[model samples]
Target: MWEETSAVDKYGASPTGESFEPGRQRQVCTRYKRKGKRHRRQTGGATRTVMALDSLPSRVVLLYDEWLKLADPRTEDWPLMASPIAQTLIVIAYIYFVTTLGPRLMENRKPFDLKNTMVVYNFSIVGFSIYMIYEYLMSGWANGYSYGCDLVDYSSNPLAVRMAWTCWLYYFSKFIEMLDTIFFVLRKKTSQVTFLHVFHHSIMPFTWWFGVKFSAGGMGTFHAMLNCCVHVLMYSYYAVCAMGPAYQKYLWWKKYMTTIQLVQFVMVTVHIGQFIFMKDCPYKFPVLLYIVGLYGLIFLVLFLNFWYHAYTKGKRLPKVAQKSKALQNGNGVHHSNGVAKEATNGIFYGTTNKVANGFHHGNGIHNKEK
Candidate 1:
C-alpha cells in the first residue's frame, strides 16, 4: 500500500547519477520526518497504520470523535434521540390507542379486508429482520465476540460501528412492528392482540432505545440476533396467513410455530443468564441485561400458558354457544350432502360431525349425528 515517490524532478532530471534538485529532495525528507513525529505523538495507541486505511474503521474513528462532542447537544435536538421519557410517552400513547380506543372505534364497523396490506407488511418485516440478523453477525458476533463475557466496545472499530448500526436498526424495527397490533385492530382481529402480544410490541422500542444509545455491541446483543432469526420465520408465517383463507390448508405448522416461539424465549433467558455466572465481566449495563432476561422469562411463562390453552387443554365451547346448541336440533339443518346439524363456531371451529352431511364436529366443529 505504499505510495512510491521518485527522487528526480519530472521537469528536469539528468541521465543516471546526478540529480538537479538534490537540495529540494533533502528539504522534502526533513518535512516528512517532522510530520511523522507529530503523527506518532497524536496517535498514541492508535498507531494502527493498516487499520487506519480501512474504509469502515477510518469512518468509524472520525464519527466517534464527532459523536463525543455532539452526544448531549445532538441528543436533545434530535427527534428520536431526545430522551427515554419521550420514547416512553410515545409507547404509552400507542398502547392507549390500540388496546382501548382503536378497538372501541372499530366495534360497530365491519372488519376491513386487510389481506393484501397484511401480506405486504409481514413480508417487509421478514426482510428487515433477516437484514438485521446479517448485520448483527457480520458486524460483531461473527468476529471476536465471546458471547459469554464480552463487554460493550466503544472503540471506533469497523465491527463495533456496524454493530451499532444494526442495534439502531433493530430498535427502529420495533417501532415498525407496532403496526402488528394496529393491523389486528383494522381487521377486527382484536383477540390476536393478547396481553403478551401487546406487552411485547409496546415495550420493545422503548427499551431498545437504551440499548442502541449505550450498549449496541456486546454479550447483550445475542438475544436480539436470535429474536431476529425467530422473526424471519414468524413473520413469514404471518405473511402466508395473510395471503388468504385458501392458504390455511398449508398452515399445518401453526402448532409448531408456537413451539418454536417458546424455544426462542427460552434461549433468550439462557443467554442473558450468563451475566449472573460470569466472574469478571465489566459490562457496565447490567440493568439492560436484567431487563432483557426478565422480559424473556415473562414471555416464556405467557407463551407456556398460551400453549396449554391452545393445544393441551383441548377446545371448550362458550356458554352461549353451548346453551344454544343444547336447545336446538333440526332448526337450521340444511341437508344437501346429508345434514348440517350445527351452526359454525366462528372460522376456527369448522364442521365437526357428519351423519349424511359431509362434516364432522369434535371440538365445536359443526357435526351431523348418524
Candidate 2:
C-alpha cells in the first residue's frame, strides 16, 4: 500500500498503475477537453474561410447574371450580343497576332505583295460602308429621325427592327476592319499598325456590342452613320492607292482625310453633347449619352494631336520633295542633279521613297500614305 501511494505521488498513477488519482485525472481530462475545443474552433474557422473562398466564383457569376438582366431582351438573342466572350476573345487574338506573333513571323520574311488583295479589300469595305450608310438613313437618320433628341426605338416596328439589324451589321463591320491590321502585318507595313489603329479596331466591336444590345438607334446611330460616311472616303482613298503609282496624283486630298476625321469626331461630340441641356430627354439609358459624349471628346483630342503632329508640325513633306530628299540621302553620294547614284536602281529608289514618306497620320488608320 505504501509503495502504491509512493508510485501515485511520484508518477501521478493510482495503485492499478493504469489510472491517475480522481482529482489529477479530472485535471488531465479537462486539459484535453480544452485542447479539443480549441482544435474544433480552429477547424471551424478554417472551414468558414474555405467556404468564403469557394464562394468567390459563384459571386462573380451572380453579378454577371444580374448585369445580363439589364440588357435589352430584344437584342440579347442577337449574334455576338448573347455573350461578351466571343468579342473579347476576338479582340485578344487580334492583339496577340498583330503585336506579337505576326511581327515575329515576318522578321525574316519578304513583305507579301498584297496590292491586288488590298484593292479588293478596300473597295469591298467601301461597298459595305455604303450599304450601312443607306441602312442607317432609311431606318432612322432619314426616316423621321430628329437628330437633336433621337431616342432608341426599342420596338418591333419595321423601321426599328431595320435599325437594330443595321446596328448589328455595323458592329460586325468592326470585326471585318480588323483585317486591315492583318493586311498590314502581311505586307510588312508593321509601322502602320499603331496603338491608335489597334485600339480603334478592337474597341469598336466590343463597345458596339453593348450599343446594339442597349441602344441600337437614335442619338447613338449618328456616329455610326458619320463613321460609315468617313469610311467611304477613307477606303476609297486606300483603293485608289492600291491601283499603283499612276494613281498617286488622285491622292492630293490625303491630308484632308484627317481633317474629315477630325470633323467627324467634332460633330459626334457636339451632337451627343446636346443631351446635357435638354430637359426631360426621355432617352432610355442616359448613361449611353454620357459614354458617347466621352468617346467623341476623347477621339477628338487624339485625332487633333495626330493632326498637329502630322500636318501642323510640317512632318508630312510633299511627295516630290520627299522623293528628292530620299534620293540624296540614299547612298550619301549625290550626282550633279542632286540624285543619289543608286537612284537609277528602281528598287533602291522605291525603298528610300517609302521610308521618307512613312509618316503617321489618318484614322489610327489607313496606311503610311496618310
Candidate 3:
C-alpha cells in the first residue's frame, strides 16, 4: 500500500502507521538528496532528471521503495563462491587444447560418427534452456518486474535464492556447452569450429560467472533469459539435423538460423542499453550493465561477420574452383549480373583451324581435300 508520494515526501513514516526515528529519517533523506546530486553530476546536467522516479510508473517506484529496498547480495555463505578461478583456468585449457591440440590429434585418425551422441547432447541443452526460462519467469519476471531498473534480491527469501540458483545454473550450462567445438573436432567438422564459435562458447561462461557472483538477478537477467530461449531453438536445430538424413527436409529454413541469431543479439543490446540512458535504476551496478551491453554489441558484430561470409561470400565458387575456372577461361574469369560466365565460346576458336578435317573430326563440318 505504499504510494509514489512516499518515496520523496513521506520518508519519515511507513504505510502501516509506524513512525521512523527522527535521526533515521534524516539519514534516509540525506541519501536521497545525494542520489539526486550524483545523478545530476553523472547525467551530464539533466538536473530535472535528478528525480528519476518521475519518469517511471508510480507503482514501480513504490515497489522499489518498499519491498526491493531490502535486497542484500553480499552475504558470505553463497555456493560455488570459490571455484570460479579454477573453472576459468580449466576453460582456458579447454580452448587451447581444442583449437590446437585436438584438431592435430584428429588429423590422422578417422573421424568418429557421433551422430547419436550429438542428438542426445543438443536436446539435453534444449531441455536445460527450458528449465532456465521457467526459473527466470518464476523468480524474477513473475514478481511484477518494472522491466526498467529492477535490482537483484540478495535476501535469503526463497524466491530470491531461487533466482540466484537459476543464474548459477545458467552459468554452468555454458561450461557444458563448451563441448560444442570438441564435438566438431571429433567429427572432423573442423571447418565448423571457427573463431566466432569458440569465443562465444568459452567466453560466455567466464563472463557470466561475474554476473552470478555479484548481481544474480535484475534487469541484467533479461538478456540471459532471452539467450536461453534462443539456445532452445538453436540446439533443437542441431538435434534435428543429427537424426540422420530423413530430418534434412525439416532444415530447409536453416538459412534463416543466422538471421535469428542476429536478432537475438539486437534484442540483448537494446535490453542492456536501457541502463545507460535511464537517470536512475534501483540497481547500483551500472558497470555491469555496460559490460553486458558491450558483450551484446561484440557478439552482434561477430555474428554479422559470420553471416556475411557464410551467406554472401559463400555463394561464390570456392578458391580452388575459381582457380580452375580462370585457368580454363585463359583470359580470366568474367562476372556479369552476379553470375560467372566464360569470356569466349568455342566456335570462334575453330575459325583459326585452317578448316582441316572439317575443323576436327566428329564436329560435322564438310571440307573437301584433294
Q: Give the number of the best model, judged by TM-score.
A: 2
User: Candidate 3 residues 128-246, lDDT tens each?
Assistant: 99999999999988776777888888787889888988888888887787776677677675655556556667777767777777778888898888888877876776677667556
User: Can you give the lDDT of residue 30 in candidate 2?
Assistant: 68
Q: What is the C-alpha lDDT of each candidate?
A: 0.65, 0.73, 0.64
Ranking by lDDT: 2, 1, 3
lDDT of 1 by residue, 47-95 (tens): 5654656667779867876755533231234347655777788799889
Residues 32-124 of candidate 2 have per-residue lDDT tens digits of: 667777877999999999999999999999999998787777788888888999899999999999999999999999988877887888889
What's the TM-score of every candidate structure? 0.63, 0.80, 0.63
Model 2 has an lDDT value of 0.73
Q: Please list all clashing residue pairs in model 1, or write none if there are none.
A: 338-356, 338-357, 352-360, 352-361, 352-365, 352-366, 353-360, 353-361, 353-367, 353-368
Relative to the true structure, candidate 3 reaches a TM of 0.63
Candidate 3: minimum summed lDDT over ten consecutive residues — where?
361-370
